[model samples]
Target: MKLTIFDCDGVLVNSEEIYLAAELEFLESIGAGFERKAYMQSFMGLSPGMWEAKLQTCVEAKTGAPLPRDFYAQIDRISTVRLEADLAEIPFARQGINKIAILRCVASSTPSTRLRWKLQHVGLIDLFDPHIFSGDLVANGKPAPDLFLHAATAMNALPHECVVVEDSVNGVIAGKAAGMRVIGFTAGNHCSADHGESLLRSGADIIVENYDDLAAAIERFARPH
Candidate 1:
């Protein structure tokens, strides 16, 4: 059976912007000099723990005080509030999901607790299999292939038979490294000004702008070679 793995944040829940905004606000509140453009460039697709450490270092350097352990807690609180206030639906996600016949799962850099809550809030929790593989579950996260490999194994599918839908360069790299066909989703504005070329260079076989295109790409991928 063919397996399809989805990246959770930008691809499913429109949480990328929410996350960036919350991070910036939190960093600024803690007296960290946050430049949105720079921060996005560096941390857009990094695992939560990596981002947290990077943010802490930045804050420490700027404020001359080590970032509090609760800094991430504050950011999570802000993220939760913002998500509740402006929960966004990925364009055509429901319809596209209904069209797919492949076994599906989520492979995300988000922690399981936050990932489940986001999916639940967006009414998409039931659409995927119970096994949602988070980066924290693996020794190394995205760009390491561990999460995608783990998801493929859980779905009982060979890596070559899996198609990964991702919105970030790191995720595309991970999918490719895991031996899956990677499709980059550009609709969420996850990439920089180059649109999806960065993702393409990172190893995405195809880059789509919307769920319609995403569905079409999957259908094509499932076709006999």
Candidate 2:
């Protein structure tokens, strides 16, 4: 059976905007002056470790100073409160996922602990459960093939038999690099006007705008005529 690898944040949960808002607020308060467009385009799909490193680099380059003490802790506090208040599943995601009969698991840049928490909060944890894999499990994350390849191996599926459902350019690139067919999902609020084009440029085989179309897309790849 084919396997479906789902990306957590933007693809399954509508939490990117919450994270973006909290980060933007914190950065602005710290005088980082990070632009929204620049941050989204450059950092959307990176793992937490990579994001902090890159963000700190950008902050220092802009302000000639490293991030303030407890920067991430503060952002976490803000994001947690906001997420508790606003976190929700992507529209029709649960319904769409239920329609997929093939083996499926979540492969995300989020650390395992938080990934499970978010999925549980949004009622998606039961859908993937122990099969969920995180970037923290590997040495490399999105934009590299490591996490996807690891997930494929763990699921006992070949790279070519796995289909990646992602919502970011980095993820699409990673999936293609892992020799998997990638479906770029753009229904997340974080997606900009050119988001789909960017994913295509990054090597996504198809673009799916909403969960309403996702089941059909996955079926096409999993059981081709």
Candidate 3:
């Protein structure tokens, strides 16, 4: 791979658990509930704005209750407080990143400010500061390929020359659609039991259960033909 693109929340920084817990707590506060695994499966890669716009019905269907008007605000408040205090880097992710010979960057569904906060808080900012990009950079997010394509262009690499490490199905679909090889990561606390299968179904080229194996996966799966 000539370029390595990483998703932020779960792949680069270990914040998915915090995000999921905050979301579930918000749902509880609103008297709505969801089956945790099902929620992760259906909404793992959505941004906060997209979550409200796109998954409102999904949440209602899964929880058997409609979302409150304040759902987004509450979820955002809780998640911001929690992550600002507790965001941490993924174990071995930095080690694996450092071992790679290719150029690298981050392309996440997170908004730019929040993405920077988490990465800087966890001391990962220096590794990809200037190159970090958010879904807001494009007209569409994951499952549409715009964000990944934008990342590839900004990094001066073609889609076929990039490898994406992602922890969610939408991300895998986006990477594949952008013509990059994707490695599905199940190392996050929020990963469902069937996460790997879901990502594979969405077009991941490889599945990695831990950051320790990410470098090898990139080598094996993202090679030029």
Candidate 4:
């Protein structure tokens, strides 16, 4: 049996814009103004810890002011509120998941608590609970292969028998490094104009823009060569 690994934020839920909105607001509050397009292209797949560090450096660079250590917490609080007010699932996620015949689980960079909360909020917890894996459990996040490899091991599957469905460059890179097949997903609102091309260059084996195509992609991958 093949193991299918999913990325939560942009691939399963329509929450990328929620984080972007929260971050953009926080940056504006601190005197930084970044275009949404640039932000998504540069940082769509970073873990919160990494993003916080990057944002701290950015705030200091842009405004010539030391960023408060509490900035990350503040953004997390804001993000929670925004997500609760406006969380949505990708249009065809349920239908697609119902069609897939392989074993699947989520492996995300999101902290375990937030990951559980968000998936529960969207009613997707049942689909992946007990099998949810977080990068928080590892020393490194995506683009490093730790999280995916960990999930594969937990599921008793080998790297070559796994297929990663992701929407970000870092995730695809990590999947490739882990020796798994990678499918780039671009149906989310956060996808850039060149999202597919970027995902491919970063090492995705294929790109699927919607869940219907995702089902087909998986079936195609499962066939013997």
Question: Which candidate leads in TM-score?
Answer: 2
Candidate 1: RMSD to truth:
2.3
Q: Indicate which candidate wins on lDDT.
A: 2
Candidate 3 lDDT for residue 137: 90
Residue-level lDDT of model 3, residues 1-225, one tens digit each, is 799999998988878899889888777666666778777766777766676776687767767777777777777888888887888888877787888778999999999988998888988899897999997898877777898899999999999889998998778888888999888999887777788998898898878998777777788755546
Report the number of clashing residue pairs per model: 0, 0, 0, 0
- Cα deviation in Å at residue 160, candidate 3? 0.8
- Per-residue lDDT of candidate 2, residues 115-207 (tens digit): 999999999999998999999999998889999999999999999899999998888989999999999999999888888988898899899
* Candidate 1 C-alpha lDDT tens digits along 1-225: 398899988898889988877777777776786777567656777798777777677777788899887877777788889989987768778888888888899999988887888888888988985968888899887778999999988889999999999888778888898999999888775445675877787889998888876667898997887
Distance from true location, Cα of 196 in model 4, Å:
1.5
CA RMSD per model (angstroms): 2.3, 1.5, 1.9, 1.6
Q: In model 1, which range of ten residues has the least summed lDDT?
A: 186-195
Report the C-alpha displacement of residue 87, candidate 3, in angstroms: 1.0
Please estimate how well model 4 matches the true structure, expressed as its whole-model Cα lDDT.
0.87
What lDDT score is found at residue 100 in candidate 3?
A: 78
Q: Per-residue lDDT for 42 in model 2? A: 84
Q: After superposition, how far is residue 78 of candidate 3 from its true place, in Å?
A: 1.1
Q: What ranges in model 3 sit over 4 Å off?
A: 59-66, 222-225
